[model samples]
Target chain A: MASVNRPNKQQNHPLDDLIRKDRIPHIWCPGCGIGTIFASCLTAIKECVATGKNGFDLDKFVMVSGIGCSGRAAGYVKLDSFHTTHGRAIPFATGLKLANRDLNVIVFSGDGDLFAIGGNHFIHAARRNINITVICVNNLNYGMTGGQVAATTPYNAKTTTTPAGNAENPFSLPLLAYASGATYVARWTMLHTRDLTVSINEALSKKGFSFIEVLSPCPVNYGRRNKEKPLETLKLYQEKSIIKNGADPSELDIDMEKGIILGKFVDIDKPTHSEKYDKLYRIE
Target chain B: MTENTTESRVLTGEHFMTGDIACAEGALAAGCRFFGGYPITPATEIAEQISLRLPRVGGTFIQMEDEIAALTSVLGASWAGLKSMTATSGPGFSLMMEAIGLGLCTETPCVIVNVQRAGPSTGLPTQGAQADMMQARWGSHGDYEIIVLAPSSPQEIFYQTITAFNLSETFRLPVIIMTDEIVGHMSEKVIIPEAGKIETVNRLRPKGRKDRFKLFEPDPNGVALMPAAGDGYKIHVTGLTHDEKGYPVMTVEAQAEMMARLTGKIRNNIDRIIQTEELFLDDAEIVFISYGVSSRTCLEAMAMARSKGIRAGFLRLITIWPFPDDQIRALAKRVKALITVEINLGQIHREVKRCAEGKAPAYLVGHPGGTVIPPERVLAMAEEVL
Candidate 1:
C-alpha cells in the first residue's frame, strides 16, 4: 500500500519529508530527550522501510499521542496522526487499529499521560493485547506543566507538586506492561538511541501489545530542582546500565543512584484481540 | 430509492423486538459496519444484538474496555470510512462526555445511544427516566451544538436511530439517540424497510486535487469534506482548536474562527436537524409537550383529557438538542398553557417556558425520576392546567 503512494521527492533531507518541517524547532527545552526519542522512532521507520522486512507500511502508519511534551510527536509525524485528549493515547490508538486492520498504530506519549490519568486505558489495552506499539517517554516528572510529580516519579523526589518530596513509589513500567499481558516489553534510555530504534523496529514487526519505556531527561525542571546536570544524569545512566535480556520485569525497579536494569525483558507470541475475536466469530 | 426488500442485515418483515434490538438494527440498516460498545444495563441489549448480527454481515463488533473507549473506537471507525455507533446507560454516558466533545471538535461522524436510567449517580439501574435530556444538550464542555433524538417506542427508536446517523453523517457531528430504559426495554413490532428504500447519509468526500485539500478548511456551508486516513490524505485530527491547516492555533482569532465553524455548521442548519411530532395542536387550549417515554404517556393523557371534555394537544419532540424552539414558540401562542411532561423534574420544561416567554404558562408535570410518568398523573396535570 505504501509503495503505490509517491514519497515526497521535493525535500532534500530524508527525514525532512517525513516530519512537519514547518512545525520545528519543537517546544521541548534544551537538553530535553524527547526530541532524541522522536528522531529515533523516525530513523527506525526509515530503516525498516530500507530493510523491507521489518513490517513498516508507510501508508498504514499512524501516530497517536496524548497531551505532554512527548505528545507533540504525533503532530510532527508526516503520517496520519491523531492528537487526542490527555491520558487517551492508548485507547485512541486502539480505536485506529481496531477500526482498520491496515493501520499500524504507534502510541507516543509521556509517563504522566500514559500511567497516571490514562492508567486504566493502558492496563486494559495491554490486557486485551491489542495489536499496537506503545512508546512511553518516562521523564520522572511531568515536564510540560513545569515538573509535577507523576506516577513514574522517583520516590522522595522533589517536584513542584511534591514540594516536600514524593511519598508514592514510582511504577516499574516494563513490569506493569508485562503483567497486563503485553506480548513484548523492553526498557531503554534516550541515550541508547541505536538500541531503542532497534527495539522500536522489532516491536513494530511483532504482534499484540508491545510496549517500550524510554527513560528520558527533562533537565530544565526535573534536573535543576534535583541538582543533577543533563550530562551528569546521562553519565549516571551509562554507568548504572545493565544489559540483561529476559530479566524478570518485577525484579528490575529503578534506583537512580544505584544500578538500573536496561534491556528487553519479555518477548513472546500471543493471539491479539482482533485475531482471537475474528477466529471465534467468523461467519460462513 | 425503492428496490427489493432483501438484505442479510435488514429484515423487511415485521418482528417483535425490544427498543435496544431495534436501535441496533436501525444502525445496521443505516450502513453502520462498526459496533464498539461496553455492557451497561438497559443498553447492553443493543451491543449484544449488534455483536450477534454484525459478524454475519461482515461488520465488526468490539466490546471495548469502557464506555470511554467504546465511543473513542466508534469515532476511530467512523474516520476510517465506516459508519459506527455505540450504546451505554447514564454512567457510561457520563464517561463518554469527553469523547463527545472530541468528536464534535474533530468533526468526526459517529452515533451514541444513551438508554437513560434514573441518575445523579446510578439512581436506578433498570428503571426508565428522561433525566439526561439536559446533559445531552450541555454535557460536553465548550460552546458547541449537537443533534439529539428522543424515541418513544421500539418502532420509533428504530427510525430515530437511523435519522440520528443521517444527521451525524451529514453534519459531521456526533449524533445522540436519547431513548430511556422504558423504550429501550419495551418489546414491540418494528417494520424494517428494504435497504435501497432506507435513506442513509455519508460525509462528503474530497474530490479534485488532493494537494489542494486542507483538512479543516470549511467550504461555504461551514463543513469541510472529510477525508479518511490512509487514503494518501495524511490528515491531522485533533481535539484542540485549530486552523484550516489542521494545526493547533491557540489564539483568540483562531479560536473564534475554529469554534464558529464547529458550531455554525449545525446552528446554521438547525431547521434541517430539528424534528417534532405535533398532534391535534390546532384549535387546542391545553398543550402537552414531552419526549421519550414521557411522550407516550402524554398521548394517553391527551386522550383521557378529551374524555373529560377538555380540549388538549401534544407536541412530541423527536429532535431534543435543537430543542424544537419554533414548534414550542408556535404552540405557546395557541394554547392556554403548555404542560411539559417528563420523568425527570422539568428539564425540557424549562426550554418550553423560555420558548413560551409569557405567551403561555409552561407547567411541569414531573418528579425526580426512578420510573416513567403515569398517564393518570399527566392527565391530572392537564386538567389542572386547563
Candidate 2:
C-alpha cells in the first residue's frame, strides 16, 4: 500500500527484442511452464548468435510450430516464424531448411502436436537426420483443448477425455527419438532450466536432427485433475528426476512413482539429409 | 548424366514427350527450383521425371511421405523464395485440400498439378477420368477463390504449366494445373522455347525499410511484395486470420479485412485470370462448353454438328475458376441452348446453368468417368437440345 499510486514505469525484458511485444500478455495460463521453456529457447538462440557458433545467424533463424498451446510460440517470436497446419511443422521446416541450407530452422511445438498427430513426420525426419532443432514441450495433456487425453498423457492421469483415468501408456519421447535415429536426443524438465538451455544450445550446434523433450507443467489443466498443484509438480520434478547423462533411452520413460531419467541420451554423428543429397545428386 | 547448362535447363527444342515429362520441363523452364511430391497413379511419372531432371538443373526434388506433407513442403519452400510444385491424382489431391486452404490463407505461391483419376475413394487408380473437375473448383473447405487451368494435351500442358507458375507468382497463391489421366499420359510434340524467349514472372520483393514492411499488406494489385526467411524481415505467417502485418488478430473486423485481401486479389483481376478458347461462336445458335480432355471431344462433336447443319459453337475453358461468368452470361443471352460436355456426370454443367440464368437451356453430355465421353454422345445431346 506504500506506493500504490506511484507512476507506472515501462520495463523491458532481456528477450524483448526477440519477442513480438504487441502480441504479449501471452495466452499461457498462470502456472503454465511453457513461458519458461520458451525463454530458455530464446536464451539458447541468443547464446548461439553471440558466439556465432555453428553458423547460427539471427536473421537466418526461423521458428516453425504446429497447432497446440505451444504452437502459438511461433506467433510470439519476432523471428521469421510460421504457425503451420497441425502436425506439418516438421515437413514444412524440412522444406524450408532443404530449400536454403543457410537458414537455421527450429520447430517449437507441444507433445500433442509433435508426438500424436505428427508422429509419422517426427520419426521420418529423425530417420533422415535432417539438420533442424525440434524442442517439444511435453505438457502431458492437450492443454489447448481443455486437458483432453494426449499421446503423452501419463498413465492413470485424469483428463477431460479420460476422467475415469487414462488406460493408455505414454510415449517415451527420448526413446522414440533414439530408435528413429536422431543424432542428438535429450530430456529435461522446465525446473532444470540451466540443463535444458545447455542441451538446447548443444543441439543447435549439432548438424543433424536434434530433439530435446522439455517436460513442462500444464497446472491449470493437468495438475488440477491429477490432484497436484504447480508447486507439487515442481517438487516432484526436483526430487524424482535423476540427471543420468548418456543413460539408455529405453530406461528414460517418465513414471511419477518411480524416477524420471533426465539428460542427454543419444549423441552421434551422421551425414545430414542435405549432406547426403549433395554427395549423391550434386556433381560439380 | 546430361550436362547442366542453360540449354539443358530449357531443353530448347521440339521433342515428342509425354504430358508428365513436358510438364516437368515446363516447370524447369519457369524457374521452379523445388518440387515436393508423392507418387500417385497417372501422376507418378511427373514425380519420376522431375526427380531425374531437377537435380541436374540445380533444383531440389523430395518425395514426401504423403500428399499432405508434399503440399505443405511445397508451401514452405515457396515462402523460402522458390517456385515450388507438386503433382498428385484424385486421392492425393483430396489429401492436399487442407494444405491448399493453408496456402491460400498465407498467400503462398506454388503450383499444384492434379492429374485426374476417377475417385470416390480409390474408384479407378490407373484409368483416366475428368470426374474431379468440381473437386478442383470447391475442393478446399474455405471461401477463397482459386486459379485452375485445364490443359487438354501434352503441348497445352507444357505451356499451361509455365503459365500456372507465372500466375501463381503474379497473384501470390497456389495455381492448379487440372490435367486428367488422358492428357497426363498422352505423348505429343511439345515445343520448348529457349530460356530467354520465355517470359517468367517472379513474385515482387519488398523494397525500402525492412522493419516497416508488413507481410500481408497488399499493393495496388492486391498482392504484397514477399520476402524470404533469411531476408531479415522477421515476418510472422499463419493460417489464422491475420492483419496486414501478418499477425493473427482474432476479431471480426480483422477477419473481414483479411478475407477481402484474400478474395479481392482474384475477383478484381478476373479478366487477366480467365482464359477461354472460342470456335465459331460469332453467329452460332447453339454453344457447347467444355474443358480439359473433354474439350477435345467437344471440338469433334461441334464439327460433326456443323456437318449436320446444327450451327454448334465450341467454347473451351482454359481457365476454369473465376468461371468466365461474363462470357457465359453474354453467350446465354444470344444462344438458344448450351450443351456442356465432360467426362464427369454434369459438374461444370451446373455452373453453366447457373451463369446462363435460364436465358438459354443448358444440358450436360457426361459419362460416369471410367472413360472419356465420345463425340457422338455430345453431338446427340446437341441435336436433342435443338
Candidate 3:
C-alpha cells in the first residue's frame, strides 16, 4: 500500500516537503543537538512511510505534541498533527490512536513535558502499553520558555529557575519506560544521529508502546548559560555515557550528575491496551 | 415525514426499562455506529446495550477505562467520520470536562449523554437531580458555545438522542443530551420512529480546489464547511486559536477575530438552534416552565389545573442552553405569573426568572435532591401564583 502511493520524483518527497525552509537557522543556536535529533526523526518517519508494514497509510499517521521546544517537532511535520495543551500530548495521542487503531500516532515531547508536568500520563500510557511511539527529547532545561531546570536536568546544573544549582535529582527516561511496561525502550544522543534514526525506525516498527529518549542540547538556554558550547556539550555526553547494551536493569544506577546512556535498552512482547480492551469487549 | 406504524407500535410494547436503556434504543435508531464509553450508572445500561447491539450491526463499541478516554475516543471516532457518542453520570461527566473542551475547540461533532445524578462530588449516584446544567455550559476551560437538550420521558429520550446528534453535526459543536437518573432509568413505552422519518444532518464539504478551500472561513451562513481526513485537502487542524486556514496564529488580533467568529455563529443564530414545545401558553393566567423529568410532572399538573378551571399552561424546553429566553419572556408578558418546576434547588429556574424579568411574578417549585416532586407539589406552586 505504501509503495503504490510513492512519488516518482525526489522533489515530491512528503517528508522533505514537511520541513519549513524559512524557519531554518534552527531555533537552537549553532552546535545545539536539536537539529540533529530532528533529522533523525525525519529519517525514521520517512523510512516508516516507505517500507511501513501493512502499507503505511500517511493519512493514518498523526503527531501529537505538548508545550516544549521539542513538542514543536509536530508542527514541522506535514501530517495530521496536534499541538495540545501543556503536558497533554500523550493522552491526546492516546485518544487519537484508540479512535482509529489504524493510525500510527506519535508523541513528540520534552523532558519537562513528559517527566514533569505530564509524568502521570507517560507512566500510564506505558503501563497500558498503547501501540503508539513516544519520542522524548531531553534537553535538560526548559528551552522554549526560559532557562528553567527540568526533571531531566542534570543535578548541580545551574539555570534561571535554579540559581545556585539544581538541588533535585534527575530521571532515567529509558529505565522509567522499562519499569512502566513499555514494549520497547531505547536512548540515544543527538550526536549519534544515525544511531538515533535507527533506534527510531526500530521503535516505529515494533508493536505496542515504544519509547525513545534522545538527549538534545539547549544551546540558547542551558548550554550558553552554563558556559558550555554545543561541541563541549556533545563531548560531555560522549565522555559520560556508558555503552553497556543489554545491561541488567538492577545493575544500572542512572546517576543524576552523569550524562545520558545511548542504546536499545528493552524489547519485549506484551498485550497492547487496545487489544486487551478488544478481548474484554468481544461482541456477543 | 410519514409515520411508520410498524416501528412505533413495536417499540410501544410493555417492558421493564431504564432511562439509559431507552437512550440506547434512541441512539441506535438515530444511526449511531460507534459507541465509546466507561460504565457509570445509572447510565451503564446504555453502554451494555451498545456493546451488545453494535457488533450485531457491524458498528464499533468500546468500553474505555475512564470517562476522559471515553469522550476522547468518541471525538476521535467522530473525526474518522463516524457518528459517535458516550454516556456518563455526574462523576464520569466531570472527568470528561477537559475532553469536552477539546471536542468544542476542534469542532468535532459528537453526542454526550449525561444521565445526571445528584452531585457536587458523588452526591447521590442512585438518585436524580437537574444539577450540572450550568456545568455543561461552563465546565470546559475556554469561551465557546454548545447545544444542550433536556428530555422528560422515555419517548423523549429516544427522540432527543437522535436530535442531539443532528444538532451536533448541524452546528459543528459538541451536543449534550442532559437527562437525569429519573428519566434515564425509568421504563416507559416509547414509540420509536422509523429510519426515514428521522432527520439526519451531515457536514457540508467543498468542491473545486482543495488548496483554495478555507475550512474555518464561513460564507454568508455562519458555519464553515468541514473537511474529513483522507480527503487530501492539506487541512491543518488545532485546538489553539487559529485563522480560517486552521493554522495556529499567535497574535491577539487573530485571537479576537477567531473567537468572535466561533461565538457569533451560535449567538447570532440562536433562533435556528433554540427549541421549545409550547402548550396552552397563549391565554393563561399562570405559566409553568420546566425541563427534563420535572417538565413531565408539570404537564400532568397543568392538565389537573385546567380541570379545576384554573387558567394555567406549561412550556417544555427541549433545548436547555441557548435558553429559549425570547419565547419564555413573551409567555411571561401574557401570563400573570411564571413558575419554574424542577428538581435540585434552582439552576435553570434562575435563567427562567432572568428571562421573565418584571413581566410577571416568578416562583420556583424545588425538590431537594434524591426524590422526585410529585405533580401536586408543583400544582400548589402554580395555585399560589394563580
Candidate 4:
C-alpha cells in the first residue's frame, strides 16, 4: 500500500520513481528542447513531494493534456492523468477540479490547443484564475499530426501548411496570461531545466491559475521544417532566448531578431476563480 | 407529508405540456441546488423557471455569458458538490459539446438539457425540432459513451430529469435530456411529487486512505468510485486514454482497452439505461415510432389510423440512445412498415431503417424546425410506407 501522508525532505513520493528510466533516451530527437521541459516537470513534481514531511498522495493529483506533442507528456506521467481533445484541456481540467476541489489540477498542452481551439477557455480560466496549473509547451507548430502552422508559429516560420511562410503573428503567451489575469505566469526553455523546475514548483504551490510556457522542440514537425536538427534547435533556443533573472512581464516583449525572453514574467495576488466562486456562492 | 393533490401541489392542471417545463420541475424535485444557463429560446424557460424557483428554496442560479461559460460555471459549482444542470438550444448546445465531452472523459456527473432546434448552424431558433439526436450521441470526438433521454410528454420530463441526474451519477457520464421547442414551450399539469420519493444517484466514493486511491480504478461493476475534491483522497483523473490506475497510457493496446471500457459501460448496461414506451402495437400492422413532441402526433395519427381500420401502432422513445434498437427491431419484424416521425428531415429515421434492416420498410415524416409536422402528414406517410 502507498503512503498517503506528505513526504519528508529526504524521501521522494512513489511518483518520482515511476518514470521509466530505460526510456530515458527520450524519443524526442537530438537537439529538440522538449526533453528538457519534460525533465523540469519530473524534477518539480519529485521535489514538491520530497519536501513533504509525509508521503505526498499521488492520487489527489490529475494531469490533463490537450492535442499536440507536448500534450503527450500526460501519457508519460505515472499519475492520475488525462489526455483530452484539442484546445479543450483547460475546460476538462476545470471539470476535474470542480468534481473534487482537492485534486491538484495541472494542464500540459501545446500552443495550438491553448491559443487556437481552446483560446476561450484559456482566457476565461485565467480571468477566473481557477486553482489549476497550466504548462504550455510552445514548439511554435502543431508537432503531433504534422508541422502545420500553429497559432504560436513564429511569423514567417516555414511549416508544411505554411508553404510561403506563416503570415500570421504569434501570441506572446506570458503577456496574454498576465493580461488575462493569471496569478502566476512564467516562461522557460527545455535547455533551462533547473530554473524551469524552480519556476514550476513555485507555480504548483500557488493557489490560483499558474501558467508556465516551455519553449520546446519539434524535431519532426517544427525542426525538420526549419532544416534544424534537435541540437541545433536547442542551440537556437539557448543562444536566441534572452534570459533575465526576474523580468518584469509588462515590459517584456519578443524581438524577431533576438527571440523570446525566458524568465518569471508575472507573479501577483488576486482572488482565484474558485475563491471568487466560493465567495459568490457563499459555500461554507 | 401531504399527498400532492391538485389544489395543494406546486403547479396544477391537465393541459398539454412540453418536456422543458417538466424537466425544470423534475430538477427542482431532484434536489438540484444550482442551475447556470443562458437564454436560448427552446431552453429559455428552464433557466427562467430555475432562476425564479431556486431562490425560493435557497438554491443558487445564474445566467451565464454563453453556453461554454454556462457549462464551465456549472462544472465549478458541481465541484462544490452541488447537483448542477444547464439547458440550451442548438447553437448553445454546440458550444457546450466540448465541455460535455470534458464532463464525460473526466467522469464528472452533471445533467445537460438540450431543447434541440434545427441546424448545422442556427437553422431555426424560435421553432422546434429534433435534429440534434445524432449529435447527442457522437458530437464529441473520442471513444466515450453518453446517456441521452428523450421525453414525449411534460409528465415524462419531470420523471426523466431525476433519471438523468441518477444515471449521470451512477455512470459518471454526462446525461442529456433531449427535447425540442414544441415540448419545451407546451405547458400541462406535471405532478410535483414529494421530493423524498424521487430517487437521486450519488457517486460512490472510496473509503480508504487517499494513498491507496486510484481515481480511475474500476469497482466490481467496472465503474470507478468517484472521490470529489474535498474528500481528502489523493486521486488522479484525466481524459486521456488511461490505464485502470488512472495513468495515461500511450500504447495502442492501452488505448484500445481504455476505449473499450469507456464504451462498454453503456453497451453492457443498455438494458438498464435504455428505456421506451409502446402504445397500441400488439395487433397493429404499421407502427409509428417517434420521440419528443413528434410522438404526440404519432399517437394522434395512430388513433386516426385505427379509426380508419388500418390497425396502426405507436412506439414512444423515452430513451433515445442506445437507440431502442431491440424493441424497434422486434416491432419491425412484426409490423408491415415503420414510420419514424421527427421534426428534422430524417435523423432518427435512419436509425429506424437500420433497425428494421429489410424486415420492414421505414418511412420518414419530417418538418424542418419551422413548422410542426401535422398528424395528417404522418398519416399520409404511414399509408404510403405501410
Candidate 3: regions farther than 4 A off: A1-15, A20-35, A141-171, A219-231, A250-253, A256-259, A270-284, B1-16, B205-208
Query: Which has the greatest TM-score?
Result: 2
**TM-score ranking, high to low:** 2, 1, 3, 4
Best candidate (score: DockQ): 2
Pitting candidate 2 against candidate 4, the one with the higher DockQ is: 2
Worst 10 residues of 1 chain A by lDDT: A8-17
The residue-by-residue lDDT of candidate 3 on B41-73, one tens digit each, is 688989987777665555677666578767876
Q: Local error of candidate 2 at B270, Å?
A: 0.6
Task: For candidate 1, give the docking quality class from DockQ.
Answer: medium
Residue lDDT tens for model 3, A157-233: 89998899989878878878899899998887887788889888888888999998888888888988888887887
TM, every model = 0.96, 0.98, 0.88, 0.82
Question: Evaluated with lDDT, which candidate comes out highest?
Answer: 2
Per-residue CA lDDT of model 1 for A1-284, tens digit only, reads 77768876665765786887777767889999998999899887777777877455787788899999999898888888899988888877777787788888899999999999899999999999999999999999999999999999889899999999999999999999999999999999999999999999989888899999999888999998888899988987799988888998888799866688999999999999988888988754
What does candidate 4's lDDT look like per residue over B339-376, in tens digits?
A: 88998888889999999997998888887777678999
DockQ of each: 0.61, 0.82, 0.30, 0.21
Candidate 1 lDDT over residue span B1-386, tens digit each: 12122237787768888899899889988988998899999899999888887877778888888888888888888877888999999999999999999998999999999999988887799888889998999998988888899989999988988998999888889999999888999999899888889998888999777666798888777788987777777788888888888888779999999888888988888888888888988868898888888888888888998888889988888888887787788778878998889888789889999999979988998878778778999888777766
Regions of candidate 1 where Cα sits further than 4 Å from its true position: A1-12, B1-7
How far is each candidate from the true structure, as Cα RMSD in Å? 4.4, 2.5, 5.5, 5.9
State the lDDT at A78 in candidate 1: 88
- What tens digits encode model 2's per-residue C-alpha lDDT throughout B166-244? 9999999999999988899989888888789999999999878998999999999999999999999999999989999
Judged by whole-model lDDT over C-alpha atoms, candidate 1 comes out at 0.87
